[model samples]
Target: MTAGHLAVIGLGPGDEELLAPLARRMLDDATDLFGYGPYLARVRGAPGAVRHPSDNREELARARAALALAQSGRRVAVVSGGDPGVFAMASAVFEAIEAGPPAWRALPVEIVPGISAVLAAAARLGAPLGGDFCVLSLSDNLKPWPVVTRRLRLAAEAGLVIALYNPVSRARSWQLGAAFELLRQVLPPDTPVALATAAYRQDESLRLHRLRDADPGGADMRTLVIIGSAATRIIDRPDGGSWLYTRRDVPD
Candidate 1:
């Protein structure tokens, strides 16, 4: 067995402080790095390391290329914005391995997870995810819209806080509005929704709104929308605004 391997690492949510120590070490130790251009730009890699920057849409191809490099006895790193396992390169790499030659499966691959968008946003917004929650990506690139809406309805019906990734993009702007409306059907008008954009970054913004009044227009590609369950509450701050949180126990 070759000592060369693949390290799939997460850089965290656009903030270097949130980047995990193991992930930072993996990036510095990598002989090669593969990821989207913007995500690759965020990394400070080894001086001699080669970066294979591709468009965000080229996940599978990038996964295959990284796998090939790793299989050839190179220390390769596949980087993602947040936790690599959560809706990122790890899944893409696994999909490529599943369909690729059997040798690809034998390649040593390590998943180094870091702070996810959901966790980052939740931390910024207090304890909105203190209790049960389900994370979903609203991007319809691979899944059907019906499936997305179905899961949203089910999560709301079950009184589960919903952390939505990829809430709005140029191509899917309407989906978030539709999702908000769907959640409203199952949740209350006063349900708290936290819109966290570019969480932990210099441009980070966190806004809280009731489900009835939350605006879908505020979100962008970098936003993580957390919709609270029935058990979620808002505590008005003495200074101004409020903190959003979910009760650990659902009262009977």
Candidate 2:
């Protein structure tokens, strides 16, 4: 077991204040921090900590860098936007440690969870996920398309509210449309759908539309789509905001 320790911190969406007190303290005290380029830029001022930036395809490399620094007895903070355990680098970190030196198995690792994008989007749309929900990433880069499609079908058929991440990207535009088509087979055409773009960021945009009308082509990598179940109701607030609700039947 390595004598060093590593702290994995989630920075939330884009706001610095959303960072937990513990995460802020770790970032401040750490001698080295690692994260994707965009997520790393959010850290305010930590002159003592050296930043290690990794591209999207270098998950293993990023994990190795952080583990190496931690194994060397340096306090290291690995930053991830949203919740690290949710489609983030937390798993990669663990996988790297498991595959490395035997001492790494004993390293003290702390995973501090943060607000995920789905939660942020749900809050923005007024509790769209107040009931049963499932989060799915539309990016088939890692998972096969068949597996993604099957999960979508099952989730839709089970009437579970859906939170979609990485819905659409430049190179994978058709995937969202395909998913939409699959979902429509099991869900009502008028099911409420919330498209949240760059959520919690300065350029945030939130749009509430019916599943039948939501254009998947308009979505981007930063967009999160919340598709309500059949029982979900949309109430328009007098203040021009909308609220979604799912009622549970009380046993008589």
Best by lDDT: 1
CA lDDT of each candidate? 0.92, 0.83
List, residue by residue over 17-56, the lDDT tens digit for candidate 2: 6778877888787888888887887786478678888787
The candidate that wins on TM-score is 1
Error of 1 at 5 (Å): 0.8
Write down the RMSD of all candidates, one decimal each.
1.1, 2.0
What is the Cα-based lDDT of residue 131 in candidate 2?
Answer: 75
Cand. 2 Cα-lDDT: 0.83
Query: How much is the lDDT of residue 125 in candidate 2?
Result: 68
Candidate 1 residue spans exceeding 4 A from truth? none
lDDT of 1 by residue, 1-252 (tens): 466799999888877888888888999999999999988987899999998999988999999999999988999999999899998999999999999999998888999999998999998899999999999999999999999999998888888999999998777789999999888788889999999999889899999999999999999999999999988999999999788999999887
